[model samples]
Target: MLEIKDVAFGGKAVGRLEDGRVCFSPDALPGERVQVTVTRETKRFVEAQLDRVLEASPRRVKPPCPYYGACGGCSYQHAAYDYQVELKTKQVGDVLGRLGGIENPNVLEGVPSPLPYGYRNRITVHRHGGRIGFHRRDGKGLVDIEACLLASDEVNKRLAELRRERFHEGARVLREHASRMGFHQTNDGVGALLQDAVSEACGSGGCLIDAYCGDGFFAHRLAKKFQRVIGLEWNERSIAQARSVAHANESYIEGDVAARLAEVLEEADGAATTVILDPPSQGLDVQVADLLRAYPVAKIVYVSCNPATLARDLKSLAAVYELGSATPFDMFPQTAEVEVLAILRRRF
Candidate 1:
C-alpha cells in the first residue's frame, strides 16, 4: 500500500515506494492519506488503485455519475465543482509556465459552462456486439451506458432509440454521421457563443476569412456581421452541408486552407480583414504561419486545443503581432485538456 504525498503534474498523487521507486494513483487527491494497492510496478513509476481511504481530504465529495470509476468520460466529477475549476486553472498555469517557458503568464479565469451536466453536443458511443457505451478505463471491457449525465438530452434520447434497434453495420455509420452534425445541445451553445465572441472582437463591416471552418459553423454566423465571409474547408461532406446552409453572401471554397489563403489574400487586396483560425490539435504548419504573416490582415483570432503548440505559433507570430487577450473554454471537463481562443493584433 502507498500513501499519497503531493499533487503531480497530471492531476494524480505522487508517492514513493519503500524500494526507492515512485508511484502514482488516481482518485487520490493531495493531503489525503490513502492505502492504494499497486496494480503495476514499472521501472520508473508504479500504477495503483485506491483500496481504502485511511483519511479522506475535505475536498473529496460523492461522485454524481453512477459509472465514475469505470467510465473514462470524467476524472474529477468526484471532486466539487469549485475545486475542479481551481485544479484546471492550476493545470493551465503549470503547462504554460513549465513547458511554454512563459513565466507568470496571465491565465484568465476559465469560462464556466452554462450547464455542467448534459452539455455535450457530441458523444461517440462505442459498439461491439450488443454492448454500446464508453470503454472501461483499464480493461478492454465495455461499460454499457443507458444514460450519460454529461451528454445532451438529444444524444441520450437518440442513443436510447438506437439501442432498441438491432445492431447492424449500417447503424454505426448513421450514428457517427448524426453525432458529427452537431444536433445535440452543447454548453453555452458553443457554436453560437464562439461566433458571438468573434463578431464582438472583430466589430462590424469588414471582410472575415475562416480557416478549417467545418460545416460553416462560424462562417454562417459571421456572415451577418462581416461585409463578406469566406470559409476554407477540406472535407467534401462537411463542405456540402455548409453550402446547403450557407447564406447567399457567404462563400465557401473546398480545398486545403494553406493553399487557398494566398488566393483569398490576393483577391482581398489590403481590404480591412480579420482571420479566424481553428486548426487541428497538431497546430498550424510552418507554411501556414508564413502565409498568415505575409497577409496584411488587421487581426487574427487563433483557437487552439493544445496550449504547447499555441505557444510555439504565438512566438512565431509575435514578430509581427502583439498578444491581445486569451480566453479559455472548458470544452472537455474531465481530462487534462482545454480550448483557448487568443486574439492577436498587428504591432503597428
Candidate 2:
C-alpha cells in the first residue's frame, strides 16, 4: 500500500513504498491510498499500476468519454477539469524549477479551454475491421467508435463520412473538416487565447522573425506591430498557404528555421527585434541553439508542446537571456499534453 502524494507530468501519480522508495503509480489520483503492483523498478524510483484505490480523492470524477480508459488518446479524463489545470500548472513549475534551472519562476495560473469537450479540430482514426477508430490503449488492437467527444461537430460529421467510405486493411486515415484542413491547431479556442498571450508579451520591437511559423499563424497576427515580419517553415504546403495570403509587410520562407534563421534576422538590422519560435515536439535543433548563441537575439517568445524539450532549450538560452514568465495553457482537456509560452529578454 502507498499514499499517492502528487500528480506527475504524464499519466502517473507520486507515492512512496513502505521502505521509503519513490513510486510512480498510474490510474490513481493524489491523496489516494492505493494498492499498487510494481511494473518497473529502477534504482532511483519504482513504477507501478494501480491495483486498487483504497481511498479516492475528492477531485476524482467519472470520465465522460466512453472510450476514456481503453482509447490511447486521453489520460486525465478521470480528474475534474479544474484539478486537471492545477496539476498541469504544478507540473510546468516543477519542470522549469528543476530541469530548466529557473529558481522561483513566475508561473501563472493555467488558462483553461473555453470548451473542454468537442473542441478538437483533428483526429487520427485507424481502420478496425470495416470501421475506423482509434487504437486500443494497449496498442494491441483498435477500438471502434462512432463519434469522438473531443472533436468538433464539423469534424465529427467528417468522421462520419470517413466511416462510411474508406479503403485498405489496417489503414490510418486523418479525417478533418473541409474548412479547417491540414496541420492547424486542434483547439482553436485555446489557440486564440495563446496567441493573445504571446502577442501581449511580444512588446514593441523593430521587427518580428517567426520560426517554425506553421501557416504563418503568429507572423500574420503580429504583422502590424513590427516594421518587418518574416516567417520560416519547413513545410512547402504550409509555406504556400502562408504566401497565398501574404500582405505587403509579411514574407514567408520555405526552409528549416535553423538553416535560414540568419537570413531572416538580417532584416532586423541589429536593432530591437522579437524572435518568435514555436518549434515541434522535438524542440529546437542544435543548429538553432548554436546560431542563437552566436547571434543572441534581443527578445524571444517560445511556444512549445513538450515541457521536457522546452526546459532543455530554456536551460541553454539562460546563458544570454533573462526569463520573464512561463505560462501554461490547458489546450487539451483529459490529455497529458500541455502548451506553454515562455518570454525572454537578452541580458546584454
Candidate 3:
C-alpha cells in the first residue's frame, strides 16, 4: 500500500515507496493521504490505484460518470471543474517553458470550453468481442459503457440507436468502411468559440490559407473575413465535404499539403495570405515546414494537440516567422492533452 504525498505533473498524486522509488497514483488528489495498491511497477516509477482514502482533499468531487475509473476516457472528472482548468493551464505553461525554451512567455489564459460535459462531437467506441467502450487506463482491460458523459446528446442518441442495431457485431468492419468523412464540429460550443477567436486574431483585409483543412471547418466560417480563402486537405471525403460547402470565393484542393501548397500559392495571384495549420498530434511534416519558411505569408496560425510537437515545430518555424502569441484551449478538459493556438507573423 502507498500513501499519497503531493500532486505531480499530470494531476496524479506523487508518493514515494518504502525503497525510495516514486509512484504516481490517479484518483488520489493533492493534500489527500490515501492507501493505494500498486497495480504495475517499473524500475523508475510505479502505477497504482486508490485502495482507500485515509484523508480526503476538499477539492474532491463526485464524478458523475459511472464508468469513471474503469474507463480511461476521463481521468479528472473527480476533480473540481475549476481545478481542472488550473491544472491544464499549468501543464501548458510548463511544456512551453521547459520544452519550447520560451521562458517567461506570455501564455494567454486558456479559452475555457463553454460546456465542459457532453461537449464531444465525435467519439470512437471500440468493440472487441461483446465489449464496447474505452479501454482501461492500464491498457489491458475493457469496460463496457452504455453512455459517455463527455459525448454530445446528439452523438449519444446516435450511439444508442447504433447500439440497438447491434452495430458492435461488425464494429471493426464498419469502422474500416465508414466514409471516415463528415462535417467536423465539436458537439460542444467550443468550435464556434474557437472560430470567433481565430477571426478576431486574423481580422480583415488578409487572405487565409488553411492547411490540413478537415471538411473546411474554419475555412467555411472565416472565408468572409479574408479577401480570399484557400483550403488544402488530403482526405478525399473531407475534400468533398468542403467542396459541398465551398462558396464561389472559397477554393479547396485535394493533395498532399506540403507538395501542393506551392502550386496553390501560385494560383492565388500573389495575394498576401494568412496561413492557419491544424495538424494532428504527430505535428507538421518537415517538408511542409520548409514550404512555410520559403513562402512569405502575412501571418500563420498553428493549432496543435500535442505541446511537445508544437514546441518542436515552432522552434523550426521561428527562423521565418515571429511568434506573436499563444493561447491554450482546454478542449480535452479531464485529460493531459491540451490544444494550443499560436499566432506567428512573417519576418520582414
Q: Which residue window of length 10 is worst by lDDT in model 3?
A: 168-177
Model 1 clashing-pair count:
0
Q: Give all candidates' CA lDDT scores.
A: 0.74, 0.85, 0.77
Residue lDDT tens for model 3, 7-106:
5545677888889889888887767778888888889998888888888778889998888877877778888877777667776777777777777656
lDDT of 1 by residue, 103-180 (tens): 676677776555667777567777876788887877776788897888777768878987897765322422323636
lDDT of 2 by residue, 70-90 (tens): 888888888998999999999
- Can you give the TM-score per candidate against the true fold? 0.82, 0.95, 0.86
lDDT at residue 181 of model 1 (Cα atoms):
54
What is residue 137's positional error in candidate 2, in angstroms?
Answer: 2.3
Candidates ranked, most accurate by TM-score first = 2, 3, 1
Better of 1 and 3 by TM-score: 3
Error of 3 at 293 (Å): 2.0
Report how far off residue 311 is in candidate 3 (Å): 1.7
